[model samples]
Target: MNISKEIVENVSGIDIVEYIIENDNGIAIGIINFGATITKIITPDRYGNLENMVVGFDNKSKYLKNFLHFGSVIGRVAGRVYKGKLTIDDVAYNLDLNLNDTHIHGGENGFHSRVWDTEEIYEEDKVGVKLRYISLDGEEGFPGTVETKVVYSLNNENELEFEVEATTDKTTVVNITNHSYFNLSGNFKENILNHYLKINADRFLPIYKNGDISGKINTVENTVFDFRKGKLIGEDIDKKLEQLTFADGYDHPLLFDDKIGKIELWESNSGRHMEITTNNEAVIFYSGNCFMKKTPFSKKDKNRRIALCLETQNLPIGENEVFKENSILRKNEVYKRTTKYKFSVI
Candidate 1:
């Protein structure tokens, strides 16, 4: 693997740089220091033509203008919190509610909005960039002075891997995930409804209009959320399901089993396929339901299902059992998680 770096923008005495890591197999991945985000990912199609596989802006100028998290790493808490309330260690912490009065993706000044310190790394077969961030104890109403490190590495096997590690001084909530919207058709000129997808899980968490997880774990046996056997993303997206109506489409969490993940996706037009494997127990599959023409998030049209997200994380945000158990990162406890996206051409 080869590594190169360039400064894309200078903001407030900070330089937002992009690092390009290329492997021998023609797979190249681009990451930016601002937000520790993935800016570009290039892979070859079946016809042997290379094209970018993720959506992102051209430079830091466009990045600063667009608030939508294209390929950035979401953190502190990746999903919504119930009513933005948390009573950890008998002290109530009121967080900034970005959407619908619920604390979503860390809060107003989340990890996605900061420029992290970066270190370039080199090895025999792989090169990577390590990004670090220090979140103050009460920056976003969280209790811990947290230190985080995320490494994005591209290797010869066409695998783009994300390894995250963090430690907090005082006990705090932490759930980190990459917010990369994928349209495996090589580009976003068209919607991703025709793409085929299959997830191994048979149960999913339902959601409310406010984006909070509602109700218990429901079976996807007879629902549109079912992707156990692999099916076109559009097959049941328009069905008259209650959850579908609430979110305008699919915005829920599907259980994950590493034994046979089934997190496989392929574009019929481009013959580009991707498989995701992760250590997180649940994943949020969010269809781009809020996209609009006025929304500067994309150059693509304001389509309902243009891009879909597969965010692997600990648990869905709401009042849940897992929330009581996994969300809190205690002091001296090192938190670690890994998610990998491997690419190929059918």
Candidate 2:
């Protein structure tokens, strides 16, 4: 494996560097210092031709206004905090209600919007990029001065892995996850509805219109949320399900039974398959319902389901006590999570 870095551009007086890490197997991963985002992932399709699989912007200026959180890390909290509030240790923390009264993926100045210190690393068999960021105490209403490092690596076996480590000086809440929009068909404008997915989860955490996950564990035995048997993304997407309708499309986090994610996904059009494994408790499934493509930043009029986010993280649900405990990071305690996505052509 080999790694190379180049200054892509400067945004808001901050230098955005792009790192290209390629494995001997011809799989390459591109990451940027801005937001520590994965800008491109080139993998082979069914025809044995390399294609970029992740959705991304073409310039750095678009990242400055990346409200969609494309290929960036969501921090402090992955899901919505009901009414932009959380009571930790009987002390209240008020957050930015970036989305109405509910806070989603941190706030306007979340990790996804900040520039991170980055460096390249190479081991015997792998090459990767490590991005480090520090969140001040009371940053975004969080109660800790947290230091975090996120490493993204690609190996020879077509495996893209992420390892996140963090520590806080004060007791605070923390839940972090990546927000990458993926379209296995290798086209950002193409709908992923035809892709087949199998998630090793029997239940889902439904969210309200405000993006807050209801603590109630709803069984997916017969609902559109069921993916245990492997179904096309479009099979139940429009089945008149309230859960699907509430968010305008698929936008809820499904509680995993055991590990983080035992997800098997594939796009038939390209015959590309990907297996996702993680250590978190749940994975949020979000279809690009808000990518109205009307934004001046978008060159294409990308609409509903143009891309998808399989965000693996610990959800914050008011009704679940265990979930509440999972979000709290005590002083000097370390928070660590790892997720892997392996790709191949079927």
- Cα-based lDDT at residue 155, candidate 2: 88
Across residues 18-46, which tens digit of lDDT does each residue of candidate 2 receive? 89999997888888888888888888898
Model 1 scores a TM of: 0.95
Worst 10 residues of 1 by lDDT: 294-303
RMSD of each: 1.8, 1.9
How far residue 132's Cα lies from its native spot in candidate 2, in Å, is 0.6
Model 2 lDDT, residue 142, Cα? 81
Superposed model 1: Cα runs more than 4 Å off: 258-262, 294-302, 320-322
Candidate 1 per-residue lDDT, tens place, 1-346, comes to 7999998999998898999999998998989988898988888889988988787887566766446677888889898888888888988888888877788888767898898999998977788999999999898888989999999988888888899999999988889999988888886656888999989888898877666876478888888888988999888888887788898888898886454344898997889999998888888998887776644344544466778889888785576323645678999999888989999999
Relative to the true structure, how large is the alpha-carbon lDDT of every model?
A: 0.83, 0.83
